[model samples]
Target: MARNIVISGASSGLGRALAIEFAGPGATLGLLGRNSERLDETAARAREKGAVVRSAAVDVRDRDAMRSFLLDFDAAAPIDCIIASAGVTMVTPVPGEVEDLTRAEELFDVNLNGAMNTIAPIAPLMRRRRAGQIVLFGSLAAFAPPPDSPSYAASKAALVAFALATRALYRADGVSVSVVCPGFVDTPMAGSYSSWKPLMMSPEDAARRIRRGLDRRKAIIAFPLPLYLAARCQQWLPDSLRTAAMLRFRAVQRLPVR
Candidate 1:
């Protein structure tokens, strides 16, 4: 059967890929993004696939705007799936330099709080319907705090925790909640990193994995078996060893070019 799907950050990256994946003759898509041009491009592509597309160029950080858009979309079509895929990475601080507190807050507002803005308004509606999927985009960095990207790690970690908790709470309600923890995905967001990105997957492939996981109603959808296993093993390592190993990792320390 056709599904009513909503995707935030659908202008690019995994969000765009997922939209394309779900688009078809019977599908209805409501996509949101900050870039009007890109968002239009995505909508056009989905329309070409015979999917009914409605798109809005709006920042996820605008809670009222996000809430209104989502609520209206749900009222119109009754959402079957909602993916909170919008997020921003914080700039890695240089050695011996402290991260700017303001920048950290900005990153959190978009990455963590923005996710809440996207999911919170729709969660109850999904519960009432008793048949919908809520997918949250986290990261492998959620497994360990990267000294270089503290804010990003913290935001993703919070998502991981929140997704798990939501899954447990909503299981009986027939509302499936899932967290996707991808490693390095080859997106503009990942392009900002200056360090080696191991096992980086294309966004299409990542989206495929995510879709499969959601179809199976997985609670945690972490990807690339090798990388995921490595991250899991890090939890068992001694703190001193893990910290020393992580300290050797290097990435760009300057503010990201938005």
Candidate 2:
């Protein structure tokens, strides 16, 4: 029997790539994205790979809409895996280049709150089934304070701790949780990066790594070894020193917008 998998943010970048990678013989994919065009593209690609592709064009922040879709999915087929990849981020400076209170709220709504909405709907089903896997997208930016992308950084960082708690709560229920932290990916999301982005992997490579880690049921899957190591170094430093270092890191991206 083909296993049922749900992917949020399936319109592009890592989520799109992941949908393609997982689509193949014996896979039933329920792809969700906000954009209809891009979602169609992803579904087409998945279908080409012999997977059963279905889509729901709904914002991740809409709790009721998400629940409606998820319940429909559960009724049609049992979901075996769920990847909550729907998130938004930007390097655009707040209160300046892209200063809008509404944008800031939207960012949080999608990145953090949206994640909860994405995961919560499917979690009950997984818990009831007593078998499932959840793969959350964390980031190297999640490791440090990102003054330039305050909300984005905070969301990812918060997820790290959230995953920790989730692991404890869900492990005994036969549901495994894995949080993937990729330093930099050459995706549309990070294309605007102006500063150094080391050991960046293509979307394909990142997707492959994500599947491998999930298959192995790893608790934390951080990649591009060197960069992951670099991020981890902050843990060894004293809090005062680490805070100072983080401030410097954000300072480098402080050049005035042209």
Candidate 3:
């Protein structure tokens, strides 16, 4: 039997690169994505590297589907890790300056709720076995909402508490919950929206760092030193001041959908 790993959002970008990074003759991969063609492409790449890859075009929001899939995937082979990489930006018909609640919900469903959906299903099994890893995708935006991406900021912000919570709760079960907060990566998802992305690395580079973090069982993995520092600083800033600054910053963008 080979070491098994499951990844969501494996159709493109970081997910695709991650599949490549973990590819090997002794590894088996279970990929989840909405696009069959793109998912097939990723599977092919992983297979070329000698990995046994299988994929399903399933929406993460479908709770029952997720649960069933996780159960079956784990049963087929002992799953060593699960990575929840599927997420969408704030595309609720709103762009910059303005902010709204509808956009917030849609993006939240895919980012935060989707994250929970991904981690929860396989948790029981991992707990019973007393060993496994869960990787949650967060963002540099989690620290500060950056006016323009309000809902997007809100969406990412929801994932911050996961690292500490998971570490404290799952330790007894020997299940490690890790969060990956990358500064910015050059991906189709990132390119779809316009923004000043700093210290952006290629998906390949991001995947490599993620792999290292998972191997070491790090509780939280953040990228590109500078962005990490800025995030920390925001955490220490005054709420009132941060709010004011955000308002001023928000003024520059058009407005997000409501």
For 117-177, candidate 1 gives per-residue lDDT tens digits of: 9989989988997888999989988996667888889899999999999999999998989
In model 1, what are the clashing residue pairs, if there are any?
A: none
Clashes of each: 0, 0, 7
**Candidate 3: global Cα-lDDT?**
0.81
Cα error, residue 44 of model 1, in Å, equals: 1.2
lDDT of 2 by residue, 1-258 (tens): 227999998998999999999999889999999889989999999999999987989998899999899888878978888888988775655433533567767777888788888889888789888988887888888876555677678779888888878988999898888888887788767765455566878999999998888888988899987878868898689988877766554422334321
- In model 2, the worst 10-residue window by lDDT is 249-258
Q: List the residue pairs that clash in candidate 2.
A: none
Reference-based TM-score, model 2: 0.89
Best by TM-score: 1
| Alpha-carbon lDDT, every model | 0.87, 0.81, 0.81
TM-score to native of every candidate shown: 0.96, 0.89, 0.89
Of models 1 and 2, which has the larger lDDT? Answer: 1
